[model samples]
Target: MLENTLAATYTPGVNLKHNVAGANWTFLLPRFALDTIVCYGVPGQKALKTLARISNNLVIVAAEASTQTMPPGVRLHSGPATSLPLPARTVDLIYIATRDAQRLIERDGDACDELARVLKADGFIYTEAGVSAGWLSQQSARLGQAVRYWLTPLLGEAQTAVPEVDAATRRYFVENDLFSSSVRLAAIGFGKRRQPAAEAAGDAANAPLRTGGRSGKRRLRQKLRPLAAALQQAAGRVEGQVHLLGKPLARRGVLIGPEVGPGIPQYLANIAAEAGVDLRGWRWGLAARGEYSSRKVLIFLFPPDEQRPSLIVKMVREAGFNARLENEYRALRWLVENGIGDAATLPQPVFSGYHGGLMLVGETIIDGTPFRAADGVETGELAERGLNWLVELATTTANTGVASAETVAAGLEVLLERYIEIYEPGAGERAFLAEQVDAIRRSRQPFPLVFQHGDPGVWNVIVTPDRRTAFLDWEAAEIHGMPLWDLFYYWRSVAIDVSRRQGVQDALAGFERQFLHESPLNATLSLAIRRVCDATGLSAALVRPLFYLCWMHRALKQATLLPRNQLAQSHYHNLLAFCIEHQDAPALAKLLLAGRAEPQVSG
Candidate 1:
């Protein structure tokens, strides 16, 4: 799991290094069978960690993570690269970082020969480092054009073409940043596959969640988005009338990316081939990250049997997607450690390494009915259950002390900037937001924090056979986050599907009712939030402040992702505006916080 002071940091320039390095190495190993592999001087045991998942036969000659415990399948072999501890012709692959390879050769002058001793006839040796090492390393030090990694074929030539690092990724890095290209990143590279014929069928499958932009310009268009997505999926599998009809109907926007774009099915097939799988008779699905902001795609490889799905790969084309994917990987690991990883409703971590000049995480698929707002799943019970789940997470991961505003913000500088830039807040709105910030932040008094599934809307939920609710997308989660935001955001979303469906006015009115009314559900929700606050040591006084902060954060984050024309219609803007108006309302004060979290029993 990746750790940072705050998860929001993005250093884009590092993309020029070894983005596709890991995939190249994995390509040399057996595609399906578990092969015996050795890792010598892998920087972070990143290769070892990923190898542990796929291969049962793994011997680690050396690694930077020697102090850490090895996973069940991995064996930590102690010895220098020149020595032979293993039988000859037994190893399938040897992964040595270029620096380590260079070190072994310098010390004994036969590291490459010793590595070859254990290799089978078909076995290969892979070495990769940053571009700092010149192309092919003819004489070991001088440059000859630019290259990512080098391969040594003990038996013969490499099986597949060498992969190219993503050149497009350079746009993300700051040219003037001091650390630019200075940091050495280690990744397991895969061999490149022959590019096949292409067409795009991704938008046709996961459009609603896959792409974010303006809602349909017209009411009819808005209503047709789901139909269009359905059309795309239908066109992929069925033949005859359904396939013929779907192709044209979905062509406009639903199947927008598929018709003229790279064939996602073929793209996935190439990915599968790179992984060494005979992926015939499989039903594949694709979910593009964000229409414009991200080229990260989630490829769902489904078995012909059509159960949920067998594998889900979060692959990135752009650098920003790496952070989000890595964040979700860490969050899932944290969940697994904290006892929330049930196979029925959650994605089990499978692989976390690079492939095809991109970073990807493989995981098991979630099985259940989706809880999308468009599906009209607006149940008060779901809100109650969602809060209960949030409370349980908070209680399980509860920390002891209060956190300051700076800590809670968690490197959201871009978010702050985006909020100001997009909203262009007038004096009155600016002052109101500013006042809320100061009032909550000025005092030395601190507020408690907890683990928050940052985007806990109904759309990210799934329900199992036994009626258990499970969350799906967790890329936006935070380890140290303000409590109550998840709950408020959740119920607010639910309200939009429920009584707030009429217009923005009704939505604000419904938001008020959820917090301030004396109904049974409201009372229960208030009690649940109070219990979580008590568990996490959150003060009642900070409740109102945190509520506005959460909405502002959501609004700002989504604003950057929204299409320009859709900016004014962002759901969070109305919600945030509502809270700003009632920031200090006497009734809001009584219900949202109160002198203490004293429960108002519903009569």
Candidate 2:
């Protein structure tokens, strides 16, 4: 029946812009049920093409896009969805079919702000993606599914199954905090999410798959360092108790370590201590849960269904606990506060560490939410969780009609601005850093410094049931030589994220400076440190050469570890040389051309 509803009325050429698919509210009627529709990423060609098919009186609303190589039909517009150039209370429907979801969403919280500004009192929106997961699965292996078009195909097919799929899809659209409320989604027709297929399996593929020398040393270090830390913890250099407490909610029992155990009892005691009451008999339960990092059980408990902390001390207690949870930033901020992340703060035992295995306790309330501050969640896990939390929070905000890429970006901007003020940039270096930004970049840096899950893409970022942000996988983070190293990484991720929405546009427009500030180590600082190392005659042989060598190491790793894509590998190689090589321009150019793609496979 649902299929029939779609097949009978929602024909290819039908104008469902402002009208619900099975409804008689034709979008063409000026004062009809459908009063307005907003469509983004529309150039003259796309507009004409879409307009030619539908009989709706839909006004084509163009959001920002690259527009550089846009076809003759796509035209530029003066307004962005985040900060629309439209009037208030004028429309009934808004459709955004553009890329740069993050920016649009960030600017105006999933167009909620815009919708509030422009739509009539009871307006509704409809959206269809331009691309989807199904379409992406049909593309090349190495290229992977670009995020931009992936959502489109999914919606297109869903439209075929449930004429009312709009509600479900729209729910997701809102939940993920997509930029446009109304959209066209492309679908791949009931296809399973697939892994990369092997390249043409034959003689040509036998070109002696080359392998790089050895991460043997790096791998050794990765193993050895963790081993040493674990060894030290075992020896009681660290203080805590370890009990194989059976799984909180299942068979898996928790291995309470000093990191989590000491803190829990202390946290409880502190809560009790502040309340001037005894919690020695307070009862709670542990859920057999592990964090994003490890496979250990967690001590999870729900407060007595009605138990609540007193309000006055609540703020101070939470502040202290949260301050502990935010220790990484605290430690890093200490350096920056002392103007340490800056050049002057260097040689102060630059500590490179992370926290992971986040064991968090949360409830539906904003303030009562709990996070693991002491348990050994490495930095990678922290960064991963932090980024993921932000993404999910942004997505949630988008769904509530309050989040968008721009909103998410704004939140990030707040954090970035905070970080920058802590470590203000040098004038000369700021200009140089500005030049390195690309109109299109994957969060994966071309410079190939460690693949520190800087942006962690969107999925890794998490949002609590209530609107709170937390990153997972802090251990996945790493130090890099380039300034704004995370910039390209975060940008690339935004590119993928936006491309998934409508089409791609810049995510770093107003966000780059924040990253430059947040990075404890950037190119300017690396250069300054290198000079310091040179001038101070630091005996550590690895100091100066290690900077350049690290880039080479990252470039080589990208070449060998990433799928055999010429552009990706070549970009890293060029970036590596830019930081390391002291050769003439011609040599650099030669390296760029060294891995020129040979077009070995055809789709």
Candidate 3:
């Protein structure tokens, strides 16, 4: 009768399932077959009922007897977590809900050891718990205390626990050395460990037996191995921390705002004094607002006083642009010495230097707000002033030697090759783009090189209350380049920003009409380009090819700089589409034809 009852309890086809604490148990099913599975701290009768569906053995250990009706064919144990009523090395798997496991580990020091006693050599115990931020240094102390307090007696040696934070939680896995009657808790985070196959095989062979003998001393020593390793790793971490604490607080190439000392204000005052500016009554304070960017820009406001005019002290903390800062400082000095623009068109620099590895520039604050494209009159005025400034910059820096047509073409070819290698365009497209690049190289036109603002987007322009435009962010200024580079970037940025604010299709339609000379926007950008060409004595034919080349360069740079950005991806795709449609243009036509052919190579 007992044999018949046992057969009835476990059927042939059913699978066990349980759910607790927002975690699904079905997902944790092991690949290998198991004769027995145990779940400690089963939360509800519903979970017990689910576990009963197992065709094989199932045990549910509850903290107390449930008032709900018990499920049939399920073995239930009621006891404290520290001591379980199970034989050694008998269980195939153990599942503990996160919260219950934490409580057990905290209250009963030998709780894990008791679980380890009943687990087979290859058995797994799974539990996950949420951890708060700063848990590594702050919360680890308490967790370590609990582990050291409870696990010492079971292992016959003190254990040092290292709490590691990963993906905002902590996970624990158990490996039992049954020969020594000791357990090792492997807490994984931040780093990985690799064990050799030979050592692993040796360890498996040397597992301890339940009965003690003369090899007891060897077993105890083996048990202390994990503890010793843990302590050594902890010592390394502490040593690294001590070394870091001994260094100066300042970062290598960036200035942290809060770490700024009281000496900075006095330093600025000295710079102003050298430049014949008095700041006796002015006080410094950080700007209330700014946009997010790669560089940390702290705007220091110097309110107008009876002694002198108001000033703006801009501190630029940049790790990536340290070299660029030197170039920009020289550019600013050139602008001041050459008298490029009045205060309305540019901020007058009173002083410029470095402090704590950060680039600092003090300038008379231009009384203006960010230029708004929606204001028609201001927009037109901005464009006119921008064109005038470009002309002045070109004329002033005209002595810089021009880049030869061959050099320009070679650069474009290199970019095309990189694009093909990275993106693996079709054979037809690649051939067409290659042909276009060759045409750009062959079609020679002599053009003078001039200073160019590498990034002259609308965001860098400010419109004062008096309707004058001021240019900002000259860190990317080039001493010599194509004059059209800055103009193209500015218009492109305006189009993109407008498209983002409005609908893409609507904005594109408007911009397309303007490009086709069907609409007038901001004094006709093409006409302004023609005027610049006429002044510089450059060929009108060079405009179309050069413009396209500039776009290609910009698109390629965007892809290289921000490979993951969706907007950059869209911009590149759109440029390809434009080239395809404008096949009448020699370069575009070649690219279009190439795109039509079969792919010659695979990615």
Candidate 4:
């Protein structure tokens, strides 16, 4: 019977990593023909492969979706650790392989409860118990001596003790009388104790008393409330749709829900259906969750099946930003019409509209992955591609307008005022910024505006395995902006990446020496500048100041909006320092002098 159960439950074809400690489980497989096994947390690939060879049914659950495809018979479930979609008391064995067991338990105590509840009588639980040096001293002498004797040689003379198990976990298991054994680095096992019939009955009898004499009633009421609310919400939505039938829907500002719910998928499916696209076989999974901002941007993926190509559904929700989606939709259409970039490099907009206060955009998924500078691409090659893209964007689009010196100066002052209000800059810093603003105001040369991708960081660009690049996130694209702004911004991102990889001091020092022509990065910058100058007949002198202006603009903008962000603060401070050191630079020097002389601008 055990052999049959093992054969029925063993999963096949799982590949496991060889380095994990739990990979030794293969030797123990002969002892028990387990009926069901669950690999929780991240298990070793080698261990999983060995388990698959022995077990027919294996389930792997984790917080994030697996990047690799699962082999046949192995199932992957993604969700918070606190919840697992499994029947109670059905699992025969549970394996949790993680370095920090206490952290795991603390993060999701309910998961531990679920593990206990699901294990059948006599079922086993295996985990890593990483205890420190004094850990054994606190335990029973017999167990402590045995563990210390076994582990002492492994610890060596320099290392007198090592972590063996977490105190809280050991107590929980010991108090419950479930701990079976401990050997080497692997904690052996625990079993669920079967409850006696009389004890169970007594507990059942006292349940109502524990709940103030309304156990069943309270349970029933709690369960019914959610169902009632769901039904009412569904009915209201249906009525709202019916009422809007054949009527022009008014454009309402952005609407946002506090949390994402099941209805989101259905709402998106309805939108797809309205656009004559069938998504009946599609399953939605979250692709990305953005940082804290008023805008809630969620990217969801619809994996390709037999009938349709893979699709990406992007939803942007905010309290009052209704026009962002509209802007993106129009920008995409314009890009497609102008053939600004390769067809595959651009998002093919399928359907875009607003629903339930969300700005929804469905586009064909790009088959590429996000580009990383460390991915073996030569620095010059990456810079060339990025610069070429900017050039293409600038040259292909017609000039919208010329932004005058006064307009630029006024904008900088507004941003500076906001920054001062939030950051409370020192007297010297405030005076310096005021002078820089004045210098910008003094420069009267107007730069021609071109359509610009407002945010062009490496993360926003997707690179195919074959080295093809495509840009994403067009919601912030501006129709009228200096072409050099995008180029300088892209350069700033590369510099930041370099700073992150190499020490900040090294990168900043490199920037100081190599910004114009000496550094490799400067070569790319020079090439981009030369190309733009050739294309637009703009002088290097005229455009040089614009780069500094662009950096200041970005720094001020980020500082004003995200005052608490240390990274933004660092960038702002760095820019100020750079300006102070290089005050001889024409545009920046003028601005600094002006800032020092000008009266403080009011909020």
* The best candidate in terms of lDDT: 1
- What C-alpha lDDT does candidate 1 achieve relative to the native structure? 0.51
**What is the C-alpha lDDT profile of model 1 across 282-366, one tens digit per residue?**
5443333222424345555556655445777776644445777788888888888778648876788765665434467777877
Which ranges in model 3 have alpha carbons more than 4 Å from their true place? 1-281, 288-293, 303-309, 373-381, 414-437, 496-510, 560-573, 583-603
- The candidates, ranked best first by lDDT, are 1, 4, 3, 2
RMSD list, candidates in order: 17.3, 28.3, 27.0, 26.0
Between prediction 2 and prediction 4, the one with superior TM-score is 4
Model 4 over residues 1-603: C-alpha lDDT tens digits? 011111221111111111111233222111224567777765656456545544567888776766655657887777755666677777756666554543564355476566656665545544333433332232222111211101111111110111122223223222322222111211111111111111110111101112135556544543453455455445444433432331222111111111112222445666777888777644333321211222334434444342223676665433244455666777888878877765577887888766545477888766665666326544546545866888778766635245565675666576566556655667887787787667656654444457788777666776766676677877667766555778766775565455434533232443454452245665566666666655654434445456555655554434322224232223444654565567575433332222112233222
Off by over 4 Å in 1: 1-296, 302-308, 373-379, 405-418, 442-446, 500-521, 563-569, 584-587, 594-603
Worst 10 residues of 2 by lDDT: 198-207
Compare the candidates by TM-score and give the number of the best one: 1
* Candidate 3, 58-158: lDDT as tens digits: 77677776576766666778876767777888876665644665466545547756766777655544433322234322323322211100111122211
- Superposed by TM-score, candidate 3 places the C-alpha of residue 501 at a distance from the truth, in angstroms, of 7.9
The 10-residue segment with the lowest total lDDT in model 1: 251-260
The TM-score between candidate 3 and the true structure equals 0.48
